[model samples]
Target: MNISHLLRQYEQGHRDFPELNLAGVDLSKVMLISVNLTKSNLMGINFSRGFLTKSNLSQASLNWGDLTYAKMSESQLIETDLTKANLTGAFMVKSVLRSAKLSGANLSYSNLRGANLSDANCCGANLQEINLREANLTGVNFNWANLSKARLSCAVLKQASFFGSNLTDAFIKEADLSHTNLEQVNFQNSRLSYSNLQGANLQGANLQGAKLRYIDLREANLQGANLRDADLEGADLTNAIVDNADFTNATLRDTKVIGTQLKPQTIQKNLSELQLKRNPNYAGSFELLSTSYAVAVFNKDNSLSC
Candidate 1:
Protein backbone atom coordinates (compact mmCIF):
# COMPACT_ATOMS: atom_id res chain seq x y z
CA MET A 1 0.00 0.00 0.00
CA ASN A 2 1.14 3.61 -0.65
CA ILE A 3 1.71 6.35 1.96
CA SER A 4 -1.43 8.21 0.84
CA HIS A 5 -3.63 5.31 1.81
CA LEU A 6 -1.83 4.94 5.12
CA LEU A 7 -2.27 8.63 5.88
CA ARG A 8 -5.94 8.44 5.03
CA GLN A 9 -6.40 5.46 7.35
CA TYR A 10 -4.42 7.14 10.14
CA GLU A 11 -6.48 10.33 9.93
CA GLN A 12 -9.63 8.20 10.31
CA GLY A 13 -8.19 6.74 13.59
CA HIS A 14 -8.07 3.21 12.21
CA ARG A 15 -5.56 1.19 14.22
CA ASP A 16 -6.87 -2.29 13.43
CA PHE A 17 -4.65 -2.81 10.38
CA PRO A 18 -2.53 -5.89 11.17
CA GLU A 19 -0.01 -5.35 8.39
CA LEU A 20 1.06 -2.16 6.59
CA ASN A 21 3.19 -2.67 3.47
CA LEU A 22 4.64 0.75 2.71
CA ALA A 23 7.90 -0.63 1.35
CA GLY A 24 9.94 1.74 -0.81
CA VAL A 25 7.35 4.44 -0.08
CA ASP A 26 7.98 8.05 0.97
CA LEU A 27 6.29 8.60 4.32
CA SER A 28 7.98 11.84 5.37
CA LYS A 29 6.39 13.73 8.28
CA VAL A 30 3.65 11.11 8.67
CA MET A 31 2.32 10.06 12.05
CA LEU A 32 2.14 6.27 12.55
CA ILE A 33 1.83 5.70 16.31
CA SER A 34 0.68 2.36 17.65
CA VAL A 35 0.72 0.83 14.14
CA ASN A 36 1.33 -2.92 13.67
CA LEU A 37 4.07 -3.52 11.08
CA THR A 38 4.85 -7.16 11.87
CA LYS A 39 6.76 -9.03 9.16
CA SER A 40 6.48 -6.14 6.69
CA ASN A 41 9.11 -5.83 3.93
CA LEU A 42 9.97 -2.14 4.25
CA MET A 43 13.40 -2.12 2.61
CA GLY A 44 14.65 1.18 1.16
CA ILE A 45 11.67 3.12 2.53
CA ASN A 46 11.91 6.83 3.40
CA PHE A 47 10.46 7.72 6.81
CA SER A 48 12.23 11.03 7.44
CA ARG A 49 10.66 13.16 10.17
CA GLY A 50 7.92 10.55 10.63
CA PHE A 51 6.53 9.70 14.06
CA LEU A 52 6.49 5.97 14.92
CA THR A 53 6.33 6.09 18.71
CA LYS A 54 4.94 2.99 20.43
CA SER A 55 4.78 1.16 17.09
CA ASN A 56 5.18 -2.63 16.87
CA LEU A 57 7.59 -3.72 14.10
CA SER A 58 8.59 -7.20 15.26
CA GLN A 59 10.57 -9.16 12.63
CA ALA A 60 9.99 -6.39 10.07
CA SER A 61 12.50 -5.85 7.27
CA LEU A 62 13.55 -2.19 7.22
CA ASN A 63 16.97 -2.64 5.59
CA TRP A 64 18.45 0.49 4.02
CA GLY A 65 15.49 2.58 5.19
CA ASP A 66 15.92 6.36 5.52
CA LEU A 67 14.77 7.18 9.05
CA THR A 68 16.57 10.49 9.47
CA TYR A 69 15.06 12.84 12.06
CA ALA A 70 12.27 10.32 12.80
CA LYS A 71 10.64 10.01 16.21
CA MET A 72 10.76 6.33 17.21
CA SER A 73 10.59 6.48 21.00
CA GLU A 74 9.35 3.39 22.88
CA SER A 75 8.94 1.42 19.63
CA GLN A 76 8.95 -2.40 19.79
CA LEU A 77 11.29 -3.71 17.08
CA ILE A 78 12.34 -7.13 18.33
CA GLU A 79 14.28 -9.17 15.73
CA THR A 80 13.74 -6.47 13.11
CA ASP A 81 16.20 -6.17 10.20
CA LEU A 82 17.41 -2.57 9.98
CA THR A 83 20.72 -3.17 8.17
CA LYS A 84 22.27 -0.08 6.57
CA ALA A 85 19.40 2.14 7.75
CA ASN A 86 20.03 5.90 7.98
CA LEU A 87 18.96 6.98 11.46
CA THR A 88 20.88 10.26 11.61
CA GLY A 89 19.49 12.77 14.10
CA ALA A 90 16.64 10.36 14.95
CA PHE A 91 15.04 10.23 18.39
CA MET A 92 14.87 6.67 19.69
CA VAL A 93 14.79 7.15 23.45
CA LYS A 94 13.76 4.07 25.43
CA SER A 95 13.12 2.08 22.20
CA VAL A 96 13.25 -1.72 22.31
CA LEU A 97 15.53 -3.08 19.56
CA ARG A 98 16.59 -6.45 20.96
CA SER A 99 18.13 -8.89 18.46
CA ALA A 100 17.82 -6.30 15.69
CA LYS A 101 20.15 -6.34 12.68
CA LEU A 102 21.60 -2.83 12.29
CA SER A 103 24.91 -3.59 10.56
CA GLY A 104 26.39 -0.70 8.59
CA ALA A 105 23.61 1.61 9.77
CA ASN A 106 24.23 5.36 10.07
CA LEU A 107 23.04 6.52 13.47
CA SER A 108 25.10 9.70 13.72
CA TYR A 109 23.83 12.25 16.26
CA SER A 110 20.92 9.98 17.20
CA ASN A 111 19.46 10.08 20.70
CA LEU A 112 19.07 6.58 22.12
CA ARG A 113 19.10 7.20 25.86
CA GLY A 114 17.87 4.22 27.91
CA ALA A 115 17.19 2.21 24.72
CA ASN A 116 17.21 -1.60 24.86
CA LEU A 117 19.67 -2.76 22.20
CA SER A 118 20.88 -6.08 23.64
CA ASP A 119 22.36 -8.59 21.17
CA ALA A 120 21.94 -6.19 18.25
CA ASN A 121 24.20 -6.46 15.20
CA CYS A 122 25.58 -2.96 14.64
CA CYS A 123 28.87 -3.82 12.93
CA GLY A 124 30.47 -1.04 10.89
CA ALA A 125 27.76 1.41 11.97
CA ASN A 126 28.35 5.17 12.06
CA LEU A 127 27.24 6.25 15.55
CA GLN A 128 29.31 9.43 15.82
CA GLU A 129 28.22 11.81 18.60
CA ILE A 130 25.21 9.64 19.48
CA ASN A 131 23.68 9.99 22.93
CA LEU A 132 23.37 6.51 24.43
CA ARG A 133 23.34 7.26 28.15
CA GLU A 134 22.20 4.36 30.36
CA ALA A 135 21.37 2.20 27.30
CA ASN A 136 21.37 -1.60 27.41
CA LEU A 137 23.94 -2.73 24.84
CA THR A 138 24.96 -6.19 26.05
CA GLY A 139 26.51 -8.48 23.45
CA VAL A 140 26.13 -5.79 20.78
CA ASN A 141 28.38 -5.98 17.71
CA PHE A 142 29.79 -2.55 16.95
CA ASN A 143 32.99 -3.50 15.13
CA TRP A 144 34.48 -0.63 13.11
CA ALA A 145 31.84 1.86 14.29
CA ASN A 146 32.62 5.57 14.71
CA LEU A 147 31.60 6.71 18.20
CA SER A 148 33.66 9.89 18.40
CA LYS A 149 32.61 12.24 21.22
CA ALA A 150 29.55 10.10 22.02
CA ARG A 151 28.05 10.18 25.49
CA LEU A 152 27.54 6.67 26.83
CA SER A 153 27.64 7.13 30.59
CA CYS A 154 26.33 4.19 32.65
CA ALA A 155 25.66 2.19 29.45
CA VAL A 156 26.01 -1.60 29.58
CA LEU A 157 28.32 -2.68 26.77
CA LYS A 158 29.35 -6.15 27.93
CA GLN A 159 30.98 -8.20 25.15
CA ALA A 160 30.56 -5.43 22.58
CA SER A 161 32.89 -5.50 19.55
CA PHE A 162 34.49 -2.12 18.89
CA PHE A 163 37.47 -3.11 16.75
CA GLY A 164 38.84 -0.26 14.65
CA SER A 165 36.24 2.10 16.14
CA ASN A 166 37.03 5.75 16.77
CA LEU A 167 35.79 6.78 20.22
CA THR A 168 37.86 9.95 20.56
CA ASP A 169 36.80 12.16 23.48
CA ALA A 170 33.79 9.94 24.24
CA PHE A 171 32.25 10.08 27.70
CA ILE A 172 31.91 6.52 28.98
CA LYS A 173 32.16 7.00 32.73
CA GLU A 174 30.84 4.15 34.90
CA ALA A 175 29.93 2.13 31.79
CA ASP A 176 30.14 -1.66 31.86
CA LEU A 177 32.47 -2.66 29.02
CA SER A 178 33.58 -6.14 30.11
CA HIS A 179 35.00 -8.30 27.30
CA THR A 180 34.62 -5.49 24.79
CA ASN A 181 37.00 -5.40 21.82
CA LEU A 182 38.42 -1.89 21.65
CA GLU A 183 41.48 -2.57 19.51
CA GLN A 184 42.86 0.48 17.71
CA VAL A 185 40.11 2.70 19.11
CA ASN A 186 40.98 6.35 19.80
CA PHE A 187 39.95 7.47 23.27
CA GLN A 188 41.95 10.71 23.51
CA ASN A 189 40.73 12.99 26.31
CA SER A 190 37.82 10.66 27.10
CA ARG A 191 36.37 10.34 30.58
CA LEU A 192 36.30 6.75 31.79
CA SER A 193 36.29 7.11 35.57
CA TYR A 194 35.02 4.01 37.42
CA SER A 195 34.31 2.24 34.12
CA ASN A 196 34.46 -1.58 34.03
CA LEU A 197 36.77 -2.67 31.20
CA GLN A 198 37.70 -6.18 32.34
CA GLY A 199 39.03 -8.48 29.64
CA ALA A 200 38.67 -5.76 27.02
CA ASN A 201 40.95 -5.89 23.98
CA LEU A 202 42.56 -2.46 23.91
CA GLN A 203 45.64 -3.45 21.90
CA GLY A 204 47.14 -0.56 19.92
CA ALA A 205 44.45 1.78 21.25
CA ASN A 206 45.21 5.48 21.78
CA LEU A 207 44.14 6.70 25.22
CA GLN A 208 46.11 9.96 25.38
CA GLY A 209 45.02 12.42 28.08
CA ALA A 210 42.13 10.18 29.16
CA LYS A 211 40.81 10.38 32.71
CA LEU A 212 40.86 6.80 33.96
CA ARG A 213 40.60 7.23 37.71
CA TYR A 214 39.42 4.02 39.39
CA ILE A 215 38.84 2.41 35.99
CA ASP A 216 39.19 -1.37 35.64
CA LEU A 217 41.56 -2.74 33.01
CA ARG A 218 42.00 -6.28 34.32
CA GLU A 219 43.46 -8.67 31.78
CA ALA A 220 43.07 -6.02 29.08
CA ASN A 221 45.50 -5.97 26.17
CA LEU A 222 47.16 -2.57 25.85
CA GLN A 223 50.26 -3.53 23.89
CA GLY A 224 51.69 -0.70 21.81
CA ALA A 225 48.93 1.60 23.06
CA ASN A 226 49.50 5.29 23.80
CA LEU A 227 48.65 6.54 27.30
CA ARG A 228 50.44 9.89 27.22
CA ASP A 229 49.36 12.39 29.89
CA ALA A 230 46.61 10.08 31.13
CA ASP A 231 45.46 9.93 34.73
CA LEU A 232 45.35 6.45 36.17
CA GLU A 233 45.02 7.19 39.86
CA GLY A 234 43.77 4.12 41.76
CA ALA A 235 42.90 2.43 38.47
CA ASP A 236 43.37 -1.31 38.08
CA LEU A 237 45.74 -2.61 35.40
CA THR A 238 46.34 -6.11 36.78
CA ASN A 239 47.56 -8.66 34.24
CA ALA A 240 47.32 -6.07 31.49
CA ILE A 241 49.68 -6.26 28.51
CA VAL A 242 51.30 -2.86 28.21
CA ASP A 243 54.42 -3.86 26.27
CA ASN A 244 55.88 -1.11 24.10
CA ALA A 245 53.17 1.25 25.33
CA ASP A 246 53.91 4.95 25.89
CA PHE A 247 53.11 6.47 29.28
CA THR A 248 54.81 9.81 28.82
CA ASN A 249 53.81 12.40 31.42
CA ALA A 250 51.03 10.13 32.71
CA THR A 251 49.88 10.07 36.33
CA LEU A 252 49.96 6.61 37.87
CA ARG A 253 49.89 7.42 41.56
CA ASP A 254 48.65 4.38 43.49
CA THR A 255 47.50 2.76 40.27
CA LYS A 256 47.36 -1.05 40.32
CA VAL A 257 50.05 -2.59 38.13
CA ILE A 258 50.18 -6.18 39.32
CA GLY A 259 51.52 -8.49 36.61
CA THR A 260 51.59 -5.58 34.15
CA GLN A 261 54.09 -6.46 31.41
CA LEU A 262 55.50 -3.30 29.88
CA LYS A 263 58.91 -2.13 28.72
CA PRO A 264 59.61 0.68 31.20
CA GLN A 265 61.75 2.52 28.69
CA THR A 266 59.02 2.73 26.09
CA ILE A 267 58.15 6.09 27.65
CA GLN A 268 60.66 8.61 26.33
CA LYS A 269 62.95 9.99 29.06
CA ASN A 270 64.59 12.94 27.30
CA LEU A 271 61.61 14.14 25.33
CA SER A 272 60.01 14.98 28.69
CA GLU A 273 61.55 14.76 32.17
CA LEU A 274 58.27 14.92 34.10
CA GLN A 275 57.30 11.63 32.52
CA LEU A 276 60.16 9.94 34.36
CA LYS A 277 59.19 11.44 37.73
CA ARG A 278 55.86 9.63 37.74
CA ASN A 279 57.76 6.34 38.16
CA PRO A 280 61.04 7.35 39.79
CA ASN A 281 62.14 3.76 40.42
CA TYR A 282 62.50 3.03 36.68
CA ALA A 283 65.19 5.56 35.95
CA GLY A 284 68.20 3.21 36.31
CA SER A 285 66.62 0.18 34.63
CA PHE A 286 64.96 2.27 31.95
CA GLU A 287 68.33 3.65 30.90
CA LEU A 288 69.66 0.14 30.33
CA LEU A 289 66.54 -1.09 28.50
CA SER A 290 66.29 2.00 26.32
CA THR A 291 69.76 1.37 24.90
CA SER A 292 68.77 -2.17 23.96
CA TYR A 293 65.36 -1.55 22.32
CA ALA A 294 65.83 2.01 21.01
CA VAL A 295 67.28 0.80 17.72
CA ALA A 296 64.46 -1.69 17.27
CA VAL A 297 61.49 0.56 18.05
CA PHE A 298 62.82 3.70 16.38
CA ASN A 299 64.43 3.53 12.93
CA LYS A 300 67.86 4.94 11.95
CA ASP A 301 66.19 8.34 11.38
CA ASN A 302 65.59 8.67 15.10
CA SER A 303 67.10 11.85 16.67
CA LEU A 304 65.23 11.79 20.01
CA SER A 305 67.48 9.25 21.72
CA CYS A 306 69.68 10.16 24.70
Candidate 2:
Protein backbone atom coordinates (compact mmCIF):
# COMPACT_ATOMS: atom_id res chain seq x y z
CA MET A 1 0.00 0.00 0.00
CA ASN A 2 1.18 3.52 -0.73
CA ILE A 3 2.01 5.93 2.08
CA SER A 4 -0.60 8.51 0.89
CA HIS A 5 -3.37 5.90 0.89
CA LEU A 6 -2.38 4.71 4.35
CA LEU A 7 -2.36 8.27 5.65
CA ARG A 8 -5.75 8.98 4.04
CA GLN A 9 -7.18 5.83 5.62
CA TYR A 10 -5.61 6.75 8.93
CA GLU A 11 -7.20 10.20 8.77
CA GLN A 12 -10.49 8.42 8.20
CA GLY A 13 -10.03 6.59 11.55
CA HIS A 14 -8.98 3.26 10.01
CA ARG A 15 -5.96 1.91 11.89
CA ASP A 16 -5.96 -1.81 11.18
CA PHE A 17 -3.16 -2.73 8.75
CA PRO A 18 -2.34 -6.36 9.52
CA GLU A 19 -0.07 -8.29 7.14
CA LEU A 20 0.53 -5.17 5.02
CA ASN A 21 3.74 -5.37 2.98
CA LEU A 22 5.38 -1.98 3.39
CA ALA A 23 8.93 -3.09 2.63
CA GLY A 24 11.52 -0.34 2.38
CA VAL A 25 8.83 2.33 2.81
CA ASP A 26 9.71 5.78 4.12
CA LEU A 27 7.38 6.66 6.98
CA SER A 28 9.86 8.85 8.85
CA LYS A 29 8.51 11.62 11.08
CA VAL A 30 4.91 10.39 10.59
CA MET A 31 2.39 9.95 13.36
CA LEU A 32 0.74 6.51 13.51
CA ILE A 33 -0.63 6.22 17.01
CA SER A 34 -2.51 3.05 17.96
CA VAL A 35 -2.07 1.61 14.45
CA ASN A 36 -2.18 -2.17 14.06
CA LEU A 37 0.58 -3.57 11.85
CA THR A 38 0.54 -7.15 13.12
CA LYS A 39 2.46 -9.69 11.07
CA SER A 40 3.31 -7.00 8.55
CA ASN A 41 6.39 -7.11 6.30
CA LEU A 42 8.15 -3.84 7.20
CA MET A 43 11.69 -4.84 6.21
CA GLY A 44 14.07 -1.90 5.74
CA ILE A 45 11.25 0.57 6.40
CA ASN A 46 12.16 4.01 7.75
CA PHE A 47 10.27 5.01 10.88
CA SER A 48 12.93 7.44 12.10
CA ARG A 49 11.61 10.26 14.27
CA GLY A 50 8.07 8.89 13.77
CA PHE A 51 5.45 8.65 16.50
CA LEU A 52 4.08 5.11 16.85
CA THR A 53 2.73 5.25 20.39
CA LYS A 54 0.44 2.42 21.51
CA SER A 55 0.76 0.76 18.07
CA ASN A 56 0.61 -3.02 17.60
CA LEU A 57 3.45 -4.42 15.51
CA SER A 58 3.45 -7.98 16.86
CA GLN A 59 5.20 -10.58 14.72
CA ALA A 60 6.16 -7.89 12.23
CA SER A 61 9.44 -8.17 10.32
CA LEU A 62 11.42 -4.96 10.70
CA ASN A 63 14.86 -6.36 9.84
CA TRP A 64 17.44 -3.72 8.93
CA GLY A 65 14.75 -1.04 9.38
CA ASP A 66 15.46 2.47 10.60
CA LEU A 67 13.62 3.30 13.81
CA THR A 68 16.18 5.86 14.98
CA TYR A 69 14.81 8.52 17.33
CA ALA A 70 11.28 7.13 16.89
CA LYS A 71 8.66 7.52 19.59
CA MET A 72 7.33 4.01 20.05
CA SER A 73 6.29 4.33 23.65
CA GLU A 74 3.78 1.79 24.95
CA SER A 75 3.77 -0.05 21.61
CA GLN A 76 3.24 -3.82 21.32
CA LEU A 77 6.11 -5.56 19.52
CA ILE A 78 5.67 -9.12 20.78
CA GLU A 79 7.79 -11.62 18.87
CA THR A 80 8.72 -8.88 16.41
CA ASP A 81 11.79 -9.46 14.23
CA LEU A 82 13.91 -6.35 14.66
CA THR A 83 17.25 -7.99 13.81
CA LYS A 84 19.89 -5.61 12.57
CA ALA A 85 17.44 -2.70 12.95
CA ASN A 86 18.67 0.79 13.85
CA LEU A 87 16.84 1.93 16.97
CA THR A 88 19.42 4.49 18.10
CA GLY A 89 18.09 6.95 20.69
CA ALA A 90 14.52 5.68 20.16
CA PHE A 91 11.98 6.16 22.92
CA MET A 92 10.39 2.81 23.73
CA VAL A 93 9.25 3.49 27.27
CA LYS A 94 6.71 1.05 28.68
CA SER A 95 6.64 -0.87 25.38
CA VAL A 96 6.00 -4.62 25.32
CA LEU A 97 8.58 -6.51 23.29
CA ARG A 98 8.19 -9.99 24.72
CA SER A 99 10.24 -12.59 22.82
CA ALA A 100 11.31 -10.00 20.26
CA LYS A 101 14.41 -10.70 18.15
CA LEU A 102 16.78 -7.73 18.34
CA SER A 103 20.07 -9.52 17.64
CA GLY A 104 22.73 -7.40 16.00
CA ALA A 105 20.46 -4.35 16.31
CA ASN A 106 21.80 -0.95 17.32
CA LEU A 107 19.77 0.26 20.30
CA SER A 108 22.44 2.59 21.69
CA TYR A 109 21.14 5.40 23.94
CA SER A 110 17.53 4.24 23.61
CA ASN A 111 15.05 4.92 26.37
CA LEU A 112 13.36 1.66 27.31
CA ARG A 113 12.36 2.48 30.86
CA GLY A 114 9.68 0.17 32.27
CA ALA A 115 9.54 -1.76 28.99
CA ASN A 116 8.85 -5.49 29.05
CA LEU A 117 11.60 -7.28 27.09
CA SER A 118 11.08 -10.66 28.73
CA ASP A 119 12.37 -13.66 26.78
CA ALA A 120 13.76 -11.37 24.08
CA ASN A 121 16.93 -12.17 22.15
CA CYS A 122 19.25 -9.17 22.06
CA CYS A 123 22.55 -11.03 21.51
CA GLY A 124 25.38 -8.98 20.08
CA ALA A 125 23.20 -5.88 20.08
CA ASN A 126 24.68 -2.43 20.69
CA LEU A 127 22.88 -1.26 23.82
CA GLN A 128 25.55 1.11 25.13
CA GLU A 129 24.33 3.93 27.38
CA ILE A 130 20.69 2.81 27.01
CA ASN A 131 18.16 3.69 29.68
CA LEU A 132 16.52 0.40 30.62
CA ARG A 133 15.70 1.27 34.21
CA GLU A 134 12.92 -0.80 35.78
CA ALA A 135 12.50 -2.78 32.55
CA ASN A 136 11.36 -6.40 32.68
CA LEU A 137 14.15 -8.44 31.13
CA THR A 138 13.26 -11.81 32.63
CA GLY A 139 14.77 -14.73 30.75
CA VAL A 140 16.18 -12.39 28.12
CA ASN A 141 19.26 -13.52 26.17
CA PHE A 142 21.84 -10.75 25.97
CA ASN A 143 24.87 -12.86 25.06
CA TRP A 144 27.79 -10.83 23.77
CA ALA A 145 25.71 -7.62 23.91
CA ASN A 146 27.40 -4.30 24.71
CA LEU A 147 25.51 -2.75 27.63
CA SER A 148 28.32 -0.53 28.91
CA LYS A 149 27.20 2.52 30.92
CA ALA A 150 23.56 1.44 30.64
CA ARG A 151 21.06 2.24 33.36
CA LEU A 152 19.22 -0.91 34.40
CA SER A 153 18.46 -0.16 38.03
CA CYS A 154 15.51 -2.09 39.48
CA ALA A 155 15.20 -4.18 36.32
CA VAL A 156 13.87 -7.74 36.48
CA LEU A 157 16.53 -10.05 35.06
CA LYS A 158 15.60 -13.42 36.51
CA GLN A 159 16.92 -16.44 34.60
CA ALA A 160 18.43 -14.10 32.01
CA SER A 161 21.61 -15.04 30.12
CA PHE A 162 24.29 -12.39 29.67
CA PHE A 163 27.22 -14.64 28.73
CA GLY A 164 30.26 -12.68 27.63
CA SER A 165 28.21 -9.46 27.66
CA ASN A 166 29.88 -6.12 28.45
CA LEU A 167 28.15 -4.41 31.38
CA THR A 168 31.00 -2.15 32.47
CA ASP A 169 29.91 0.83 34.55
CA ALA A 170 26.25 -0.19 34.23
CA PHE A 171 23.96 1.04 36.96
CA ILE A 172 21.99 -2.04 38.03
CA LYS A 173 21.26 -1.24 41.66
CA GLU A 174 18.33 -3.09 43.26
CA ALA A 175 17.86 -5.31 40.19
CA ASP A 176 16.75 -8.93 40.38
CA LEU A 177 19.10 -11.35 38.64
CA SER A 178 18.21 -14.58 40.42
CA HIS A 179 19.27 -17.79 38.70
CA THR A 180 20.66 -15.77 35.80
CA ASN A 181 23.53 -17.02 33.62
CA LEU A 182 26.24 -14.35 33.65
CA GLU A 183 29.29 -16.47 32.88
CA GLN A 184 32.30 -14.49 31.70
CA VAL A 185 30.25 -11.30 31.70
CA ASN A 186 32.07 -8.05 32.41
CA PHE A 187 30.51 -6.00 35.19
CA GLN A 188 33.53 -3.86 36.03
CA ASN A 189 32.78 -0.79 38.14
CA SER A 190 29.06 -1.55 37.97
CA ARG A 191 26.72 -0.60 40.78
CA LEU A 192 24.56 -3.57 41.79
CA SER A 193 23.76 -2.67 45.38
CA TYR A 194 20.79 -4.49 46.95
CA SER A 195 20.39 -6.68 43.86
CA ASN A 196 19.21 -10.29 44.05
CA LEU A 197 21.57 -12.78 42.45
CA GLN A 198 20.56 -15.90 44.35
CA GLY A 199 21.61 -19.13 42.63
CA ALA A 200 23.00 -17.20 39.70
CA ASN A 201 25.88 -18.61 37.64
CA LEU A 202 28.66 -16.04 37.64
CA GLN A 203 31.58 -18.36 36.89
CA GLY A 204 34.54 -16.61 35.28
CA ALA A 205 32.65 -13.31 35.33
CA ASN A 206 34.55 -10.05 35.88
CA LEU A 207 33.06 -8.04 38.74
CA GLN A 208 36.11 -5.95 39.63
CA GLY A 209 35.25 -2.78 41.58
CA ALA A 210 31.53 -3.64 41.55
CA LYS A 211 29.27 -2.38 44.33
CA LEU A 212 27.44 -5.39 45.76
CA ARG A 213 26.37 -4.05 49.13
CA TYR A 214 23.32 -5.84 50.61
CA ILE A 215 23.01 -8.08 47.55
CA ASP A 216 21.76 -11.66 47.86
CA LEU A 217 24.03 -14.31 46.33
CA ARG A 218 22.88 -17.48 48.06
CA GLU A 219 24.01 -20.68 46.32
CA ALA A 220 25.55 -18.66 43.50
CA ASN A 221 28.64 -19.92 41.67
CA LEU A 222 31.66 -17.63 41.49
CA GLN A 223 34.31 -20.12 40.41
CA GLY A 224 37.24 -18.44 38.68
CA ALA A 225 35.42 -15.11 38.90
CA ASN A 226 37.25 -11.85 39.65
CA LEU A 227 36.00 -9.82 42.60
CA ARG A 228 39.08 -7.65 43.03
CA ASP A 229 38.34 -4.44 44.96
CA ALA A 230 34.62 -5.21 44.82
CA ASP A 231 32.47 -4.19 47.76
CA LEU A 232 30.40 -6.98 49.27
CA GLU A 233 29.57 -5.30 52.55
CA GLY A 234 26.52 -6.84 54.19
CA ALA A 235 25.99 -9.07 51.13
CA ASP A 236 24.84 -12.67 51.61
CA LEU A 237 27.09 -15.42 50.27
CA THR A 238 25.39 -18.39 51.90
CA ASN A 239 26.19 -21.73 50.25
CA ALA A 240 27.94 -19.92 47.36
CA ILE A 241 30.88 -21.55 45.54
CA VAL A 242 34.02 -19.41 45.62
CA ASP A 243 36.54 -21.93 44.34
CA ASN A 244 39.40 -20.31 42.44
CA ALA A 245 37.64 -16.92 42.70
CA ASP A 246 39.79 -13.86 43.33
CA PHE A 247 38.77 -11.52 46.13
CA THR A 248 41.94 -9.42 46.36
CA ASN A 249 41.27 -6.21 48.31
CA ALA A 250 37.50 -6.89 48.18
CA THR A 251 35.51 -5.51 51.08
CA LEU A 252 33.59 -8.28 52.81
CA ARG A 253 32.81 -6.41 56.01
CA ASP A 254 29.62 -7.73 57.66
CA THR A 255 29.09 -10.03 54.66
CA LYS A 256 27.54 -13.44 55.25
CA VAL A 257 29.69 -16.48 54.51
CA ILE A 258 27.65 -19.26 56.08
CA GLY A 259 28.12 -22.65 54.40
CA THR A 260 30.52 -21.00 51.88
CA GLN A 261 34.20 -21.83 51.55
CA LEU A 262 36.63 -18.99 51.01
CA LYS A 263 39.92 -19.47 49.18
CA PRO A 264 43.03 -19.65 51.35
CA GLN A 265 44.39 -16.58 49.63
CA THR A 266 41.24 -14.68 50.56
CA ILE A 267 41.32 -15.90 54.19
CA GLN A 268 45.00 -15.19 54.57
CA LYS A 269 44.58 -11.54 53.76
CA ASN A 270 41.12 -10.77 55.17
CA LEU A 271 40.56 -13.26 57.99
CA SER A 272 41.63 -10.85 60.71
CA GLU A 273 39.40 -8.18 59.26
CA LEU A 274 36.53 -10.65 58.91
CA GLN A 275 36.14 -10.94 62.68
CA LEU A 276 32.84 -9.69 64.04
CA LYS A 277 32.90 -6.18 65.44
CA ARG A 278 31.53 -7.43 68.74
CA ASN A 279 34.69 -9.51 69.25
CA PRO A 280 37.12 -6.61 68.91
CA ASN A 281 38.84 -7.53 72.23
CA TYR A 282 39.80 -10.97 70.92
CA ALA A 283 43.10 -10.91 69.09
CA GLY A 284 43.59 -13.99 66.88
CA SER A 285 45.26 -15.35 63.78
CA PHE A 286 43.76 -17.72 61.19
CA GLU A 287 45.54 -20.90 60.12
CA LEU A 288 44.54 -22.87 57.03
CA LEU A 289 43.85 -26.27 58.59
CA SER A 290 42.63 -27.68 55.27
CA THR A 291 41.65 -26.62 51.78
CA SER A 292 38.13 -25.95 52.94
CA TYR A 293 38.62 -25.14 56.63
CA ALA A 294 40.53 -22.67 58.81
CA VAL A 295 41.45 -22.57 62.49
CA ALA A 296 41.64 -19.41 64.58
CA VAL A 297 44.62 -19.22 67.03
CA PHE A 298 44.83 -16.94 70.06
CA ASN A 299 48.08 -15.93 71.78
CA LYS A 300 47.47 -16.45 75.51
CA ASP A 301 50.27 -16.37 78.17
CA ASN A 302 52.96 -16.53 75.48
CA SER A 303 51.44 -19.75 74.15
CA LEU A 304 49.37 -20.35 70.99
CA SER A 305 45.91 -21.73 71.71
CA CYS A 306 43.11 -22.77 69.35
Count of clashes, each model: 0, 0
Query: Candidate 1 — which residues are off by over 4 angstroms?
Result: 261-263, 267-306
Q: After superposition, how far is residue 174 of candidate 2 from its true place, in Å?
A: 1.1
| Tens-digit lDDT track of model 2 for 1-306 | 889999999999999999999999999999999999999999999999999999999999999999999999999999999999999999999999999999999999999999999999999999999999999999899999999999999999988889889999999999999988889999999999999999999999999999999999999999999998898877888889889999887766656766676654653354454432222232333333244454333333322233
**Residues 154-269, model 1: lDDT tens digits:** 99998777777788889999999988888888899999999999888888889999999999998888888899989877778877878878977676655666555444455545
Model 2 regions lying over 4 Å from their true place: 267-306
What is the alpha-carbon lDDT for the whole of candidate 2? Answer: 0.88
RMSD of 1: 6.5
Model 2 CA RMSD to the hidden true structure, in angstroms: 5.1
Question: What's the lDDT for all of these models?
Answer: 0.81, 0.88
In terms of lDDT, model 1 sits at 0.81
Clash count (model 2, backbone only) = 0
Output the worst ten-in-a-row residue range by lDDT, candidate 2.
275-284
> All candidates' TM-scores?
0.83, 0.88
